[model samples]
Target: MTVRLDHRRVGLDRESLAAAYPSASASGRVVVVVFLHGLVETERSWFHRPRPGKARNGTDFGSRLAEDLAGTPVYVRYNTGRRICDNGRELADLLAELVEGWPVPITEIVLIGHSMGGLVARSAVRQAGDHPTPGLSKVTRLVCLGSPHTGAPLERGVVRVAGILGMFAALAPVARLMALRSDGIKDLARGSLHQDHRAEYGRPVDAGLPAGVRQLFVVATLSRSEGSLWGPLIGDLVVAPSSAGDRTQTADLEWLGGLHHFDLLSHDAVYGVVAEWLRT
Candidate 1:
């Protein structure tokens, strides 16, 4: 489960960095915007079909941000089957390498993540704290879209059902099949950030967001009104709104109704909120 830069699998070597970021090298002290994709997804997921009347090319959020904001947009692709913490550790190292190898100085970094990617970002921040990752100081903001911060009900349900099935010898095979899910998927049961927190699944962890970094939690619901019965119950068809934004009272929160989990990936409304927050 390797994490590479963009779809081209850009390496972190000095030569690759020089080739990939020549323009950034020419620019002075630029902000770096990193986009982290969700579970079972690649960086290409950000490239949605072009919106009508909008630009015909570069339809992804990263592309749009490059045009609107004064920053370098970097899309990271990784294997989703690995544990979140494992990926997070690697990501922290990768970012540190990027900082060390960048052609120009970096002023700040903004992380925008979707679904499981958000959890990975948080874990990366936490892992960065254990060591002196120079790039960690530059992370100024983190944006989570439909992330299961507290936990995801679907994962919990699957675990429960798998347990029940395991009790019956006749259904043990099916139970084992369900348990064969990737470690990354299993981490969603409680949004376990640290390795030690895995045992405390039923209880919520108080691992707060990184200090000095602005945080934004964006939740999407299929219901027209978030206050409706289905809103919290079927949030984005994967994550619960309460779990997604329950981490901090200080972080900015946005609840978008009548949208599913995947919709947040390319939704204009989501981009508007992100752009506005970044601008401020």
Candidate 2:
């Protein structure tokens, strides 16, 4: 019942992954960019891993972002299958631990989350609350790609069926705790991360924004158009442009066209935009 976040194991430790790059000064002002991948995706999805669909591209978004961010301090997180809010809480805890133990004087933290990862990042930021440490005080910027800030309208029967199976599995005590802790119910209730939320839930993290954290929204419009499963609906097949950008008074949202949710991570064009945003 517990959703496994790291499927590939990726051979990287959190300390090493969170570590600033060599060029980054030991003094304050190091920018730690954490890229969170969407549901059913690995950290490899952010850059390059082994993908059955594409032979040339090793994986997807994670590798691509790493490549684009060459020489920059980057950490790619691969945590899929957990509930969105639970993942956010875990992220908050991890950040708290990192900041508490960090040797160097940390300056800035940037969270670039794609699809459901974006929602998770927002939740983490919200949980950081009023007196955020290095996690939020150092957090200068946040970018969300194809995330359904509002709850998405499910495709209907699919998630319901899966929820039933998950319920059966949760009968075991260990799995029951895991299921409850993972935010499985929330995910199921909201359907998949890809569904667009026009009415169901409120903006994913709009209600949970911490005081000083900055926010950005990057949405995908088209995917191949001809043979791709994603149709031209101003969306990444799952989250629409509006849903991705939906926020209350405290957010600064941007609209990026011509990409899918996955492409927002891997595609060079999308990567360039994100890089530019970070630079600004």
Against the reference, the lDDT scores of all candidates come to: 0.80, 0.56
Model 2: how far is 46 from its true place, Å?
Answer: 1.2
* Superposed Cα deviation of residue 192, candidate 2 (Å): 12
Off by over 4 Å in 2: 1-28, 49-71, 76-79, 130-133, 154-185, 188-205, 223-234, 247-249
* TM-scores of the candidates in the order shown: 0.92, 0.67
Candidate 1 regions off by >4 Å? 1-6, 50-58, 247-250
TM-score attained by model 1: 0.92
User: Over the stretch 1-280, how does candidate 1's per-residue lDDT look in tens digits?
Assistant: 3334555777766678778766677566588888899988988888755445333353677777877896778888888888888888888888887788777778898989999888888888876567658877788898989988878899999999999999999999999999898888888888877788787554565555568888888988989896798687888899888888774445789888877888778877788888898999
